[model samples]
Structures are given as structure tokens and as C-alpha cells.
Target chain A: MAESTEVKLLGLWPSTYALRARIALNIKQVNYAFLEENLGAKSELLLKSNPVHMKVPVLLHGDKPICESLIIVQYIDDVWTSGPSMPPSHPYDRAIARFWAAYIDEKWGPTTKAIDAVIVAGEGEEAKKAAVDKVYDILVLLEEAFKKCSKGKAFFGGDRMGYLDMAFGSCLGWLRFREKLHDIKLLDPAKTPQLVKWAERFCEHPAVVGVMPETEQLATIEYGKGLIAKVRGANPSKW
Target chain B: MAESTEVKLLGLWPSTYALRARIALNIKQVNYAFLEENLGAKSELLLKSNPVHMKVPVLLHGDKPICESLIIVQYIDDVWTSGPSMPPSHPYDRAIARFWAAYIDEKWGPTTKAIDAVIVAGEGEEAKKAAVDKVYDILVLLEEAFKKCSKGKAFFGGDRMGYLDMAFGSCLGWLRFREKLHDIKLLDPAKTPQLVKWAERFCEHPAVVGVMPETEQLATIEYGKGLIAKVRGANPSKW
Candidate 1:
């Protein structure tokens, strides 16, 4: 029946958002066709499927398209019920999971983008340090969340991987790659041991290993050059 | 029995985000004690409850504080089974409701903030016109969403007041007030008939009237003066 129902994912290869949905599907053990999008030349299917955002990754399940990577992950968990639940069963726990997921999407993304600007822009040394400090403050906030909520478990979702873990997992590769590129570790082992450990366990997990791109693959010199150029073009003042 | 459960709402009177939660609780017919917050002198409860955003409206249900307006709205709906479901029952429909809610929170808020900057910032006449045009474009996208998903219903969730309706409803009073303040009708009758109609229906909604602040109240000269000062203070460059 699962095979009979068509499940397809429209995504760009390098997108952290797309990787999030892939990780969820991996956990759910659902068979899905993956269509890589050429972001520069968006396909007709991609445009039609997600006209609002016109961006990947879009999940097409039985012909109905669900946009937004986190939403898609939730949808996969809801529809394919055979696997362990992605969000916890209890209502309050579910709300907590959703809350953190939102924080990751809303807060973490912008903070990282600000960090990216500082990294890519050819700025003064002091300015760069100040910018990096601002990002560290944001990281500290997440570290606090992990400490308060994780309940001393191996993952944010406890012993098994759940939505919060996947939410952060989606960004792990990009975070690690950027850290290496900048030669500064944002998720410092000494400062944020729990998150570092969580990242290590997540990357090595069988469910994630099959889908996540290698840190080296994402941290290429070519990628850094392209990112710097794009960031420079977007915010010329900083550069 | 409801009163005994210790239901409370921490909110600011001028805040549309806070108003969203009040409207939801009003819709659910839940009896909640309203604790008006002094944002400048944030109460210990407000700080303790929502340290992340430290903003209202925070819903205290049986001593558990749920932060974020939309999240609080959803929590009220989920917890209060006696009232009608705020979101649709079907999983896909629920996702659709959430998608639009996300749009309102993410896209609509920023667009309006940009519009606010042009209006209050003493920007050049041409710049103000261009900013208004951008807002109109954003409104058109929402109008398209209404056209596609609402299925010829009065509300986004169909016959009843659902999450999306309230999400927009919370902002409707402010939208109208701001339009009047700037002397530009964003929900122009000719262009956005549906949203205009939705706004009218929403205000008159019995479920909302008790909770929604009067348009005149929000449009007061004093209110406008305070807003101008606040906006100017936040974005000094624009002013």
C-alpha cells in the first residue's frame, strides 16, 4: 500500500531545509522518489507544486503537494504511522516539540545568516569578533534550551530521534561546515558539550547517515567562494 | 470548573499578537483571568513564563505557561474539547491551516513593518509609494491563497471561525487603523474584495467582538502618536 501511494520529494541537493525532510522520511522508513531541483532554473513541476514559495523542498504525496520542510516532516510522520511517532504523543510534549522546532526555524536561521554576513564580508577584525560573539550568544540560548528540555537523554527527543533532534539535525551539516570554513567552532565542545555530543550521535545514526551529506562535501572551497560572492552581492555595504 | 483550573492570560493592550490569544480564548468560551502586562516593567510572571520571546500573550493553563500567540491559540483549541476545533480535523487540512498561519506570522508581519517604516520614517514621497506597492503585492499573494483554499467559504476554515480567521482577525483591527492612519487603503475594495469582506465579517463576529479592541480605540490620536514614537525609536535610520 505504501508503494502504491506515490511519495515524491522535490528539493535542491545542497539545501539544509530539504535535508530536514529527507531525514524525517529516513526515520519513517518511507520509500520516496527524490527530484533534485536546479534552483537557478526552477522546473515547471517545482513552480506548479509550490507556487507560493517556488522553492524546494516540496513533498508530493499522492499528488498533493505539501510545502515547508518542517511541515513536510510533520506530514510524513502523520501519514505514515507505522514507524515510531516523530512528535511525542502527549499534547503538551507535542507543543514543546513544535515550539523548539519553530525556534530553530525562526531564531537559529536569522542568527546564522547574521553570522554568515560577518564571515563572508571582508570586515575589520574587531567587527568580525563582535559579530561572532553575537552568534555565540544565540548558540548559548539554544544550549540552554537543550539543557532545560532534553531531560538528560541522548537526544532532544530522548533515547530515540524525534522532531527536535531532526530539526537541529537538518542544520548540523551546514553548521559544522561553516565552522570549519571560518576556522571557529560555534558548537564548541567545552561550551556546548551536550549539543556537540548530540551532533556526533546524530551524524553517526543509521537513519541520518544514509541521507545527510558529508561535512567535507558541504565545506568545499568552491562552495565558500560562491557563498562569499552571493553574500557580498546581497549586502555590499558590509563587504 | 473552568474557573478552578487557573486559566490566565498575560498580554499588553496595544499588542495585536496578544490580542490573537484573547480572541482564541474568547472563541473557545474559556474563562481566563486577564493580566494586563506593563511591557516596560515586565512582571516576574511574564519574564518567567516566556523568557525566550518575553512577549505576550502568554496563556497560563493550570499553571503551565504557553508562549507565542499562535501557539497559545492552538493550545487553547487542543485543550478545550467543549468548544469547536480551531483547526480542521483532517491532517492535510490542518497542515494547510498551519501553512497560512506561518505565512501570516512570517511574511505579513515583516511586510507591514516595512510599510510602517516608510509611513512614519519621513521617507521621500517616492519611497513611501514604492513601499506601499510592495505591501500591496504581499496582500495579493494572501488573496490568492484565500482564493485557492477557502473553497468559496466566508472564513478560511469554512463556515466557522478557525485558526486562520483568528490569526488574521487579530491583525484586522490594526490593519484598518493603520490604513486610516496613512490614508492608504491596503485592503482596497476593488483589488482585495475578499480580504476586505473577511475583515468586515471578522469584526462583527460575536466570537471576536468581546475580545477584539475597537478600531477607534486603536486609531486614537494618542495611540498613533505613541506608535510613531515607538517605531521611530526602533528604526532610527528610517525616521
Candidate 2:
């Protein structure tokens, strides 16, 4: 990585999207200034940088604020030439990486949101069961992708951690946090053994160890506590 | 580009997403077998290629299936080492291109869907008015981005018709067609002169000319006709 490149990351501490950028930066060994944003009272810099989305995980390379987590991750990989590259050099390989990374961005949002809403904040049993089924369906698709697409490699980016790995790895802890908080296990060992193993490897990866916040700490945060309260507030009769 | 490469695109004739892929291939001068998919009844290849989305605009390069329009466009640019690159060579430039291209993809869907449901398929005047306001808001954002980001350049991808240009260029015609069919003029010259000029330039660009389907032809298609019927069927008092 080029030294003296002034890099700053504006992020919400527990955000998976923000985590994606952080993990990418850590993997690349790029030194960056981290600004934790109060999403409730978003900063002016955040609004100006994004303008379109006004969301965080916005990367400030000097004055250019790169919005979107996955986009920022790609930007990081491209700008920083050291460490293992995120996407493979081959065009086709890059496409595959882009495809799965995009998939992670697209799928993770709705899948987790459904789980959060119906399982964490839901009022009834039927909705929770339906949400569980929906989440499981998403997990099954991912599990199959890992089985078939990984080609027996440890990570989606191949033997080493890459863009796809970072994309999922950032959220893996959040998934666990949700599971522990809500007492619901979506990534069952038998059903998604490959993903579970990948999760283990991702959690233990040196690049991610210091970067990723602990689940217990995350669970105690305002966002996580809110989710816990929602889960607990569900009708006792349904339970 | 690369000759003798077995490139095939599974696409819907009138889909803007599919159009994005087609225009990219055309720009690259890659010989692709365009398999028109009946979105009403998608083909097996389409299903197999994109089991997750089960949508059109799936590119099959040899045996590998690349799904998602923007991703496919990037893949085409990467795989075929000829013509102008979709993303610029500089990392920051590439990031900007990727950011805008993504912005177009994310914004276009909901904006058009709102227009389709309210101004076209709507039964009330108030709803139609509200939808028009919403659509205008989306257009204004794009207009602002073009004015500020492009820096008086011809396209979003800078001076040349790059990835961001292709991303928006592919869908620009659809917006025009919708405007004409629905009798609403959102892309007014006065309100969005830069985008209006860019649209004309996009339509006339050699890279896009042969690839883009005629607006008249597009308006006569089953999908286009359905939209027209909805608009016409809407309360005349609103008109």
C-alpha cells in the first residue's frame, strides 16, 4: 500500500457495511482515520460525501468520499497495491468475484432484515416461522454457492481472503449476535456446514480479529440492545 | 476484442437491464449470440444461468454464466481487451464511475416502479400527481449529479462513453419512451439541459446507435404497450 495516502472512513461502529470497508482496509494494511457516525444525528460530512444515499461507510481519500461499502472495498483493493488482491487478475475471475460480492450485498440486506423484523421484532409465531423459512432459503442458496462455486477453496476469493470473503465476514459476527440475542440459529452446522466453517475461519483471520467488534460488545450497543428488546418484547403466548 | 469466444447473452428484448449488457457487448465489438428470453416463460438456460434471480440479461461466456447487468458490463470490458474501458484506468476515476453506475441501478428501479404504479396504472389524480412529483425528484437528483460530477463532460464516465454512461445510456431511452407514452415530460430541456443533451449524444454515439432498439419499436412492444394501456386507462380527469 502507498504510504502518505490520507484515508478516512466514516462509519457506524456496528454496521456490517462499514465493517466491510474496515476489514478491506485492514487486509490491505491501509492506514485510515475512522470516524464513528451517529446515524441518528448524521454528520454534515456524511450528507455532503454521499448526497445520494447520505449513508455511512463513506471512504474519504483526501476529499473524495466514496459511498457504498462494497464499492469502497473495491476502491480500496484497486488503490492499495500491497497485500493479497481482492478480485483475481483474470477478467472472468474478477467477474465471478464481482458477482458473488454483489450477491452478498444484495442478499444480506433483505435476508437479515427479514430475520430482524419477523424474528427479532415480530409479534406472532406464524410471521416468525415464515421469516425463518425465508432466511433458511437464503442460507441454503448461499450454502450451495459455497459448495459448488468455491471449488473446494476455503474462501469465495479462493485460498486467501478476498473481496467476497470480506463482504460476508463483516456480517458473520452480526449473524451470530442476532442468533445469541434472539435464541435463533439460522446457520445450523448440518444445514450450512461449509458456511459455518467459513465463518469460523473468517472470525479467526488475523486481518479481521482486531477489526471486528466482539458479539458480546456488539450485543450491548444501542442498535444490538434495541434488537434484543424487540425480540424479548414479542408476545409470550406465541413463545 | 477476443474472437472465436463463445459468448451468448440471454436477454429480454425491452429490458433496460438487458440493454445495458447488449450495449456493453456492442461497444466491445464482441460477437455474442443474443438469445431473446420470454420473460413470461424464461428458458432453461436462463434459469440455470441465474437461478438466484431467475432474470434475463445473463451472459454465458463459454460455460460460465455472469448475472447482473452492471457486473456483466464490467465483465465484458474486462474480458475483451479492446475498445474503451467501462471503468477508467485510475483507481479514483474507476471508483467514481462505479459509484454513479451503481447509483443509477439502485435509483432507477424504485423511481420507475412508482411512476408505473401511480401515473400509469393509477386510478386517481392525486396519486398520479404525487407519482409525477416523485419521478421529478429522482430526475432532479440525476441532473444535479451530472451537472456537478461530469464537470461539463459529455458523459458520466468522463469525456468518453464509459461504464457510467453505458449504465445510464442503456436506460435513457426507456425513460424517454415512458415519458412519451404516459404524456409526462420529466426530462425537460429547461430543467435538465445537461442530461437532455447527454441523452441525445448517447443515442447518436456510434457505440450505442446500432445496439439501441428504436424508441418507436420499443413503444410497440408487449411490455411497452401494457404501460401505454395503463396510462390511457387511468382517469381522464387527471389527464
Candidate 3:
């Protein structure tokens, strides 16, 4: 056997990415030490370890530092010893899994920025409109992803929670969080109904349900309201 | 073999990423059918094949399209059943290799935008200054990347060109092209001497040298005096 090593998760409590890592570890049945971070006043260990971005969900295996959430998830999938597989095995299947994983990485940023605008933009009518447009765009994309192609599959890969599901777990948290904060229900059953169903099934999907973030973590999103508003107010041209 | 299949490459001539796929194919000694596109009037096959991005080089093996330049490189790496390895074998080494590949993807847009400013914004004093500054910022980053880390080597991974070198090959063609357009040397031996050596060696590297675009390609940059005037006249904010 290769050397056994300690696994430590350095994460922000409310981060959906952090939650994804937790669910992945639980799925692989790997026991890990969890360190909750104060994102505002990040620890010396965190700062020293991840000097490049200094972002959250830094998964440490032994002495090595893994930054970025999706990369960490991929690493976990690669490193898992005894596993009921997270990524698809065949070349085409693996390509599909990676494509969707890359898809989530590509879209999640713009979608969340949209949601942030909906809840955070204070009477800034233009920002509000942009936010609505972003949400509509994301919801439509999510709708297309679920209700269209691969419609019959339980997950992106049929009958299993593959890499795509883990990539998208970020959105599920944001969907619920945004609905509460913005006082709007974007992921309504009428629009993206299949996705809503999938999100529910995903929430209860054994490994995910047991280790997912509790409802309270969703509340912390309001902190970004002020920050995002400042960014919106600042003219991008000046930069 | 899963099925006997023909390999095809759909690409634009001046594109560096397209050149990347070309180099990888040459290195693997894989015989592939090449179809160059007229971007203004794209081919039906190109549209039907990669409807999403409609960009290239798209690697089609057995009728399956593998889009994205780096992903195509990975596919080439996987399919080159009887060729020399491009990336290292160790998991940690491969992790570092992937780190640099991913880095290039993250930096492409921002770096290219900055480079575009340098090439086209030459008409006004302020515009030229901004262009020079942008080039300096990228140069600083490349210098840091070239600096001796724990490995005591200059290349992204020591001794040999790995994933980073291959990924940077895309940037190299573009840089050389930009240098020609601007008529101001950014990566001269005087300023960035180490990087200058690295770039020279990069051009001469066995794998990279084979499919490199002609020296004349560097002379024919995609810019003009009209572009310079237009960039100078417009607000730099859009850039």
C-alpha cells in the first residue's frame, strides 16, 4: 500500500464548495479533520499555505495544499483508494463527466453574480434588471441541462452521482440561499421543475444528505450584499 | 481497439491553440486529416460538429469531437498508444503539470486582452502607456513562473517541457505575433534575459519545434494602422 496520510479540510463554514468536499469525503468513507475558517481574519496557516489566491476549501493531504474547489474534488476522486467511483471510467464517459464539471465551473460564477445582484443591489434598478436577466439565463440553462438531454438520468451520469453532480453542488446551495435572501423563488417547480426534483433527490442522495451544510449557513450570504453593492457602484472603467 | 477510426483536425491557420494540437499530433506521430476554416464563412461540418463554441482546433476521433485545445492535448496524450510521454508519471508531478495547464486557461483572456491593447492602442500616448503597462504585468508574471523554485530549474517543470511548456506554446506564438505588431520588444535578452533564453529554447524544443508556424507567420500580425487609430479613439474601458 502507498503511505497512509492525514486529511484536513480548511474551509469557510458557509461555502458551498467546502460542503461539496465534505460530501465527497463522506461518499468515499474517508475520515478527515475539519478546520472552520474565519474568512475575514483568515488564519496564518491558511494564508501561509495558500498565498496565491488565499481562498476557501483548501483541502490538505499530509503536507500538500490543494486550492480551488473543483480541483480538490477531482483530486479526491483521483486519490480515493477504496471507492464506488466518483468520475466515469470510459474515455467517452470520462469526457462527458469532465465536460459537465467544466460547464459548472464556467457558469456558476456568472449565475451567482446574478443572484447576488437580485438580493444585494439596493434600489439600483439597472443592477436589479441585470440580476433578473442573469437568474433567468441560469435557470434556463439549468432547465435545459436537466429537462432536455440526459433527461431520464438520475444524475448527469445515469444512475449515479458522478463528477458533474459534485461540480453542480455549488449551485444547489446558492439556489436555496438566493430564494430566501432575494425574496424571490427563481428555481420554481413550474420553470425548472425537473432540476428542482433532482436537487431534492441530490440533497437526499445518501452521501450528500448526511454531510451537507445546515440551513443556517445559507444565512451568511447577506454579508456579500454590501460588498457587491460597492463593486457595482465602482465604475469598471476606472480599473 | 474499440473501433477502427479516422482522426481529423478542424482549425484556423493563425490560431496558436490550433498550432498546439498540430504540435501534439506531430509529437505523437499521429497521422490526422486537417481542415482549415475560413472564420468569416465557417464550414457546415465545423458548425455541425462544434455548434457550441464553433472554434478550433476540434479533434475528431471516430466521429467524436473533443473541443478545447488543452482537453484535445489530453485526448492526444491518452490515444497516443505507442508514443513517448509528454507529462510526468508521478501523481504529484502530474498535479503540478495540471496546475500550470489550468493556470494558462485562467490567464488566457486577461492576458490576450492586455496584449490586444498593446498592439492596437498605439495611436495615443495614454493608450500606448496602458499597453506597455499591461505587457509589463504579464512579463512580471512569466518571470515569476520562470524563477527557480524548489526544483532548482528554469522551465515550468525541470529539465523537460511538460504540460506547462505545451500550454505556453499557445501563448508563445501569440507573443511573437504581438511583438511583431507592436514593433517594441517586450521579451528581449536585456530585460527578461532568463525568459528570453527560455523562449529561444522553447522554440527549439524537440516537440514544439516540429509543428511551429513559419517565421513569416510572426511577421503577419492581425493588426493595422486603422486598428491603432480606432483603439486610441475609443475609451480604453471596453478593453
Candidate 4:
């Protein structure tokens, strides 16, 4: 470990992005100091470190802050360098994985925004329907991604966990809980069977299983629910 | 040249993303075949190559297809194997560059979709107002990114023509057209003087200047105006 330096994770406990970083750290078997931040009352350290977004899963190497989970995961894979790698070999395969990873992050905003607006605040039908449609569209895209990326695999990287899986896998954790609490399953193993199957597989992995929130952890998601409700209420059309 | 392979670019000449890949190739001095696709009726080659997105700027290396402009630029940088790298030395700085890239991509959708829907179609007060707000917000974010990533640099990745600049520069080109068509001035040199200054510097680079569509090429974008209007009308609320 001659080249290794101290790696630290700056994150909130419940952030899906943060969870992705945690899972990557676990998979890479890299040691890190975890600093949890209250997203409401942002820490000076977090703000100074990631001033642009002023948010986390900021992975710090020495004093440098790597904001954005996907970038941080890539950093971990590249710098500390490890496990199965964030991207698979074969440039085409890697490109496919990157596409899905970005797609998930993009579509997640509106999809979940609509869900929370409906469940908590009960927003406009037009806005809600539009949001849900975006969600389903992304799911369809996800199904296609899984088909292409998962080539006889136990994971997205094929045979082992990769950075794309870590980014996507952690994000899905809240969906089932959201469905159960709201009485609507997004990935009905019946409809999006491939996506559901992928989730199931990810949940079983050694690194993922331990890092993921238990169903119980989601039961009292008061702050998260409130934030989503507020976000939707503030910008229904935007959602 | 043990790892050398044939390169080909499948892109629409007018597309903002396509310009990104073209600039990369021009700078790297990588020779490749260029196939301009009919976006309305996508070619079998483009569709087969990038089946998932089915979008343009699909750069195929040998047989491996790389979709998404930023991803394609990265693949080009990677496969070229040796060059003045697009991303700079520090991982944190690279993450900052990436965060800004993703932010612009995320924000551009809502802003451009809203504007293109109403402004181009020549329709609706409410939509127009909303579109204004969206674009304004993106400019603010760009302002901040320019402020944060600025290190007395010619581009977003600091000294070189990096991924973030390549990612945003496409829109910067379009922004000029948008201003001319809609009478909306974004990235105002006076307001976001830093970003506008950077764009000026980027445009001066001989490599960047060579590949980008000339003033005449952009003047003939009446077809693009129609296509964007159609897509925006179909999904007005998608933004």
C-alpha cells in the first residue's frame, strides 16, 4: 500500500448517493473516516469543501474534496484503485454502464418528486402523471441497460460489482420502501422483472447487503418525506 | 501503435453534442470517417450502434460504439491512450469539473425544453415565463461553476479543453443561436463575464475553431428549430 493515502467519506446517513460511496468503499475494502452531516444545517467543512453544490458524499483524499457520488466512486477506483473497478473492461461495455448511471441520476429527480408530491402533499394530477411517466420511461431504459450491461452476471459489472452498480444499486433502496409506504410498487417484479431481479441480486451482495438501509431504517423517514413534499409543492410543474 | 484502431463519428453537423466529439478528434488529430445521420429518421447504423439512447454523436471505435457526447470524448481520450489529458491532475478538481458537467446537463433539459417549446413554436405566456425562469436559473449555476472552477483558465477544466468545457461549449454555441432566435441573452459577458470570457478564449483555440460549425452552418439551423419544437411540444412538461 505504498501509494495509498487516507480516504474519508463526507455524507449524510440516508442519502442514496452517499450510500453508493459507502458501498464502493466497502467493495474496494478501502479504509475511510465517515463524517455524517445534517443536510438541513450544513457544516462549514462540508460547505467549504463542496461550495458549488454545498452537498455530499464528498470523498476527501488528504484535504481534497471530490463531490458527486459517481465522480467520487471513480476517484476511489482510480486513486486507491481496487476491487472490480467502477467500469467494466471493453470500452463499449463501460460506455453502456456510464450511460445508465447518468440516466438514473437525471430521471430520478422528476420520478421521485412526483411520488412524494402525491403521497404527502397530494399535488396536481397533470404534474403527478408527467412525473410518473418520466419514471416509467427511465425504468424502461433501465430494463434495456440491464439487458445490455448484465451479460451472464451476478452484478452490473458482470461477475462482480462495478461502480455503475454501486451508483444504481444504492439509489433503488428507497423505491421499495417508498412503494410499501405509499402502496405502489415501482418495480413490480411482474412488470420490470429484470430491474427487480437486478435489485434483488444487488441486495444479496456482501458489500451492498451490509451497507443498505434495513426496511426498518426507512419507516421513520420524516425529514426526507417532508423535503420531498416541500420540493414538489414548491415546483409542481418543475417536478 | 499496438492499440491503434480505426475511428468513426456518427453525428448531426448541427448538434451541440456532436461538436464536442468533433473538437476532441480535431485536437487529438485522430482521423475518422464522419457519417451525418438524419435524426428524424435515424439510420440503422446509428440505431444499432447506440441502441439504448438512439441519439447522435455516436463515435464508434473499431466496432465499439460510444454514445453520449461527454462519454464519447472520454472514450476518445482513453483509447487514444496518450495525449494532453482532458481532465487535469487532481481528482477533486476533476470531480468539480464533472459535477458542473452533470449539473449543466440536468439543468439544460428543463430550461431548453421550456424555451424551445414556446419560444420556437411562437406560443403561451405561462410557458414563456416558466422557460425564462429555468434558463435564468441555469445561468446562475453556470455563473457559480465558472467562479468555482476558474483558475485563470481558458476552459472549464482549467488550462486545457477539458470535458466540462466540451460539455457546456455545445450549449454555448446554441445559446448564441437561442439569443438570436428568441431574443434571450444567457451567459451575458457582463453578468457572467468570467464564463463569457472563457468562451471567447475557447473559441480562439485553433483546434476548437476548426471543427465547430461556422456562422453560416449555424444560420441554416431552421431544420433544428423544427425538430426541437416537435420534441418540446410532445413533452412540454418533461423539462
lDDT of every model, 2 decimals: 0.78, 0.80, 0.67, 0.74
Q: Write the per-residue lDDT of candidate 2 for residues B1-239, one digit (tens) a residue.
A: 25766999999777888888988888777778989998778899998888888988899998888888888988888888776677888787788778878877887878776877875444577877787787777778778877765778888767777887888888877787777766778788887788888889889988777667776878688877776667767553332
> Candidate 1 on B1-239: residue-level lDDT in tens?
34468899999776888888888888878887899998679999999998888888888888778888887887777777675688876668777877888888877777776777776677767887898888788778778767766779988877788888877778877777667555578988788889888888988988777667765677454655676565556653442
The stretch of ten residues in a row with the least summed lDDT in candidate 2 chain A is A230-239
Higher-TM-score candidate among 1 and 3? 1
Query: What is the C-alpha lDDT profile of model 1 across A132-203, one tens digit per residue?
Result: 777787677777767756778877777788888888888877787667555578988788788888888999
Model 3 chain B: worst 10 consecutive residues (lDDT sum): B220-229
- Chain B TM-scores per candidate, in order, are 0.88, 0.88, 0.78, 0.83
Let me know the TM-score candidate 4 reaches against the reference structure: 0.78
Give model 4's DockQ, 2 decimals.
Answer: 0.50
In model 3, state the lDDT of residue B105. 75
Interface RMSD of 4: 1.6
Evaluated at residue B186, the lDDT of candidate 2 is 73
Segments of candidate 3 deviating more than 4 angstroms: A1-3, A115-153, A183-185, A188-193, A214-216, A221-239, B84-87, B118-160, B188-194, B218-239
**DockQ of each two-chain model:** 0.52, 0.80, 0.31, 0.50
Give me the overall lDDT of model 3: 0.67
Clashing pairs in 3: none
| Candidate 4 lDDT, B44-75, residue by residue in tens | 99989887679998987887778889888777
How well does each candidate superpose onto the true structure, as a TM-score?
0.89, 0.92, 0.81, 0.78
> How much DockQ does model 2 earn?
0.80
